[model samples]
Target: MANILEIKNLTKIYKEAQNEICVLKDVSFSVEQGKFIVFIGPSGSGKTTLLNLIAMLDKTTSGSIIFKDKDLTKIDENLAAKTRLLDMGFVFQFDALLPEFTVLENILMPAIIANKKAKTYAKYLLEKFGISHLANKFPPSLSGGEKQRAALARALINKPTILLADEPTGNLDTQRKEQIFKDFAQTAKEEGTTILMVTHDIHAANYADKCYKIEGGKVE
Candidate 1:
């Protein structure tokens, strides 16, 4: 498998009260195509910050991020946004579904925004994730697991090459978390999707192809 994402000497800093808070420092990693990599760490360990940088949702203070052979750190905001829409799928710790839209509609929202033809595939994903029964229901009516599954379906609707998940199973119970991880693993395998997930649960990290532990802004 070829490298799909690369990070070199990544660092992120935040300014607060005349002090510099270093969130990440000298982090370097690479993710291969069709592989699932998990980052596990305790709270406030900068895992989320790393994910944000990788997803291009936040800028790095310094370093290089190469995705699909292009250097993201050097790109303009417009190009970064375009790249994110075209190639990245994100699952937040929370479902982040729209309360006004039905499950199907929520799943189709990304495709609509990207102006991509994906209605048919969205339906297929809904069925694959076993959320077809709730397709017409709203987000508030669903269980946590159900909502997460719906969110996953929406993220995948665009058939993204890379899926970035932030504590994807954080809100679920043990059984549901296991089920969701299984679903994620199966879907990534079938779709040849490269997944980079930030999680705290050791069991959840076990579901990934590889796992790294981040502490004090460095991977251990």
Candidate 2:
């Protein structure tokens, strides 16, 4: 498969009033198209920062994030936002579902933002994830696992080419976590979606096509 995303000599640094904190240093890797990639690390590791840089949510100190041959580090904020909405899906540590909206409405948020008719697709995703019965329920009324599942469905509603997940299964139990891992693996296999996930859970390595360990600001 072709390389869907490439991280070449990536570095990220933060300044805290005369103190310099380098979270990532000279990291490099590539994600193949339709492959499930997992990064594991402890807290304060650069794993989350790595995802942020790829998602263009944060600026890179120096490096080239080559996505489809374009340098993400060099893109303007407007283009970055558009790329994120149109080509990438994200599931953060928290579900981040809107409390005021019904489950179905929340799942349709991205489609609404993109102005695409995806209601039917959203329904299909809900059913696929076994959450069709909860479509009319609100986030506040759902359990942690249910909320997480809804968040996953929402992320996929746009059918993004790449899914960036940060500890996405933290809210679920072992069984649910494994189910989600299987779902991610299947998504990559059947739909050609490239998945880049960061988690503290070592079990995720079992489901990933490629796995990396990040520690002390470097990836191995």
What does candidate 1's lDDT look like per residue over 83-153, in tens digits?
Answer: 78878999999999999999999999989999988878988998898888999999999999999999999
User: How do the residues 1-220 of candidate 2 rate in per-residue lDDT, one tens digit apiece?
Assistant: 7998999999999989999999999999988999999999999998888999999989999989999889999999999999999899999889999999999999999999999999999999898888999999999999887888899889988999999999999878999899889989988998799999999999999999999999999998
TM-score for each model? 0.97, 0.97
**Whole-model lDDT values for every prediction:** 0.90, 0.92
Instruction: Give candidate 2's whole-model lDDT.
Output: 0.92
Candidate 1's error at 70, in angstroms? Answer: 0.9
Clash pairs, candidate 1, are none
Number of backbone collisions per candidate, in order?
A: 0, 0
